[model samples]
Target: MTPKKEQMTMKQMMSRRAVVRVPSGPASIETIDVPVVEPGPGELRVKIGAAAINPVDLGVAGGLFHQLALVDQPDYTGLGWDFAGTVEATGPGVELPGGTRVAGFIDGFDRDHGSHAEHLLVPAANVAVVPDGLDLVEAATVPLNATAAAQLVDLLGAPPNDARRLLVTGAAGAVGAYVAALAKDRSWQVTGMARAADEQFVRGLGVDFTTDLGQAWDAVADAGALQEDAFRAVREGGRFIGMQPAARLPEERGIAVEVVFARPDGALLARLLARVATGELPARVHAVAPLDEVACAYQAMAQGSIRGRIVLVP
Candidate 1:
């Protein structure tokens, strides 16, 4: 449907603390006040109640423009995306079910300033109203990963049955965990790869099996490119999905390796929320903190010790 918009004037800069990466290293939370912007046509203004810190936050905070943009990129940016909050106003013709509770993917990857603030203005088309009773924190964590997984399973020409024998790296992580659960729930035989330490954790997620990354490689050689051997874990023609695509899969194996770049999708996200409402989807508590704690959260991510999602509450 065409969206409705809200207008504003007498704008002033709004200070927001973001995980910015200067040339030196990780940036601390600096309050940056951008001039107050009214929602333009097809746009909406969100009073960001929470924003989650993703791995992307770390890269941007370190000034890795190329990585953030997925290429030899343009402008540098501050960290964040993945927001959960309320609609403040909508731009011309952009109707957002006014005051609706929503969570949508951050356009931060545009390599510009992002959702790590008290307020954010985004394209109305990019958001979805979060279901009632869902935790806003989980809402912040669901976007990027869920959107990508849906694309691979629904958009990539892969039938649900074809998703069996799935192998997901970082399976114990936020996105990976969701992928592992959704695929299994859909009747796909799933196997998740994580550090040996997380074997039990991944198994508890109801995956068909778990591969301890440490043990698999020492004996497997091309273990890094497990595509050929990975299919053996499933029925014939099973697919291998990866956040980072491994080396080529030998054609003889009929193993399809899907490399993904997931964005947020309101429709798929709503489906996930429906699952949450139905008790089919498990929402794990990663870490919950206020916006001021974002700096510490980024530090934990950089050190590689955070066990779950890091959400910033405003």
Candidate 2:
């Protein structure tokens, strides 16, 4: 069913708990009611236990994406994306039944129903079972970040076989760190760009070089003028995957620069979830808070001061 449905066939559903943003000039999270959803075809309604607050959550809370939202009144939006929860119900034509613990990606629903809730209804295309022996809180963190990293290396054109040199921006953060680690596993040489204080941390993530944009990716003459040295490091045809827009152009050097805006994908999430279960990857849970603290969680993201995932507990 579409997000507008008020009630469903299941009458026993609780009006789920959620944190909604009320727009004045600033943003804050407040308690709101949500309907218990029955999954339609290719749908899954998760009884959310752990949901992570990410940058998008903060942006939605602050109304940073009002222009991008398909629905207006995004100020009244629900504000979380990453989650680890259990299957409360499955829609028609599904493989698994209820009670499967899953972690997957979520794009906020019409700027309204996000993962910062007691229960969440997510598309079947964005789900997978949580890896065996994985902590639910930790499992919530992997999906969005994985999608961002994977989009650059997997969805976009990155030569899989070559030992290419690549640049990762925001390398000390969750997504970047995971990207660097994953690159190492895939035999790519990784150079991580971060503030000096985060150098060692980035290096620990299996990155070969940790530098500020000046040394790592090369600041490129204050980001306005291009530097030959910077171009040389990436080599011709090397990739630059980043969350931020490049302040300068890379085409001058024939380098491929990709801006990866993350998306939710259940199939991808299933693979990542499988990797975590197989001990090929690790997921980290930074903090866990109840749904009421979603505002604080979003605030942490907006401030750029978080180290790992922030979960909203039911």
Candidate 3:
């Protein structure tokens, strides 16, 4: 007779490991062993191969989102939101088999475990299959930035029949670049503000107009110091997609301002992943290092002016 399958005891189920850092600050980053996690029902435990670092990682490390209760008081917090990996295990009620490759974002600020670790527990609904022929390391950059950019596009609603003009500030930034690409595909007359040096790069994304931020300031405000000259470039009744919630801009001229705050939406993420797979989007990987070298990665991110994402390989 065939032997019955043995159930995983609590100890056996917890053998997977991860890295922990006290306070999660760039200056305080330290690697420590963490209990292997088992996915709950409808979840999958992914063996992460690559993770992406964003500016928000810096903020979280610095204790900026403490009020969100994401940091652990007695133990260290894990730090990462974007990841790409293969599923090694699944919880009860999940049908995905082991070895299926996928990618997704976790709410790093609110979860005990994050994407930077060796193994991560993620909701089955949150992940999308990596498109055929796309590298998992490159696919790691998509979730967070793509979700945010897609949210911004949705918030702006559809472009009018006349093809309303839109200006994307920080167009060369990760989220900004994604937003520009998506908006361009949606038939918006997209104008992007980028460094003078990035004009050609921005244009490569099919931006109809590319101008230095300095020249566009007068388009929106004659005297407001917080507004970039790019605001003036939009048609008075058109739209502006700002990258941050606090993106200060003049309220005059009836120009609508929509701030992008990206959240995990599986349907939206799936759509964005399709674009990435087809080369309609760019992942823009600037640097890659082992997960243990996260401190160096954070340091490089803090230095600023790096155009693409810094990825961590586990």
Tell me how many clashing residue pairs each candidate has: 20, 3, 8
Task: Please write out the lDDT profile of model 1 over residues 1-314, one tens digit for every residue.
Answer: 22322222323345464635343344444555566677889889888887887776676666554443443324335567788899988889886777898888865344556888877888777888888888777777777766665665553343454233445556777766776676665565556787778888889888745554332211111222354444344344445454432444453345454555566667777887777656666655577777776677677667876676778887
Model 3 stretches with alpha carbons more than 4 Å out: 1-25, 67-74, 161-163, 213-240, 243-257
Give the least accurate 10-residue stretch of model 2, judged by summed lDDT.
217-226
Ten-residue stretch with the least lDDT total in model 3: 216-225
Deviation of model 1 at 49, angstroms = 0.4
lDDT of each: 0.63, 0.65, 0.73
Candidate 1's TM-score reads: 0.77
Q: Which regions of candidate 1 deviate over 4 angstroms?
A: 1-24, 67-76, 155-163, 213-238, 244-255
Instruction: Give the per-residue lDDT of model 3 (tens digit) for 1-314.
Output: 23333334434454322334455567776655566767899899998889998888877776767745545555666678899999999999888889988998986465556787788888898998887887878889999988987877777666767746566777788887887788777677777767788888889898854554433221221111234455666565656555552455666677775555567776778778888888889888999988888878888898888988899987
Q: Which candidate should be chosen as best, given TM-score against the real structure?
A: 3
Residue 121 lDDT in candidate 1: 82
Q: If the candidates were sorted by their lDDT against the true structure, best first, what order would they fall in?
A: 3, 2, 1
Residue-wise C-alpha lDDT for candidate 2, range 8-126, written one tens digit per residue: 53345665555445542124567776667678998888888788876656655565566455447534666667888889888887777788898887664465677777777777777
Would you list the rank order by TM-score, best first? 3, 2, 1
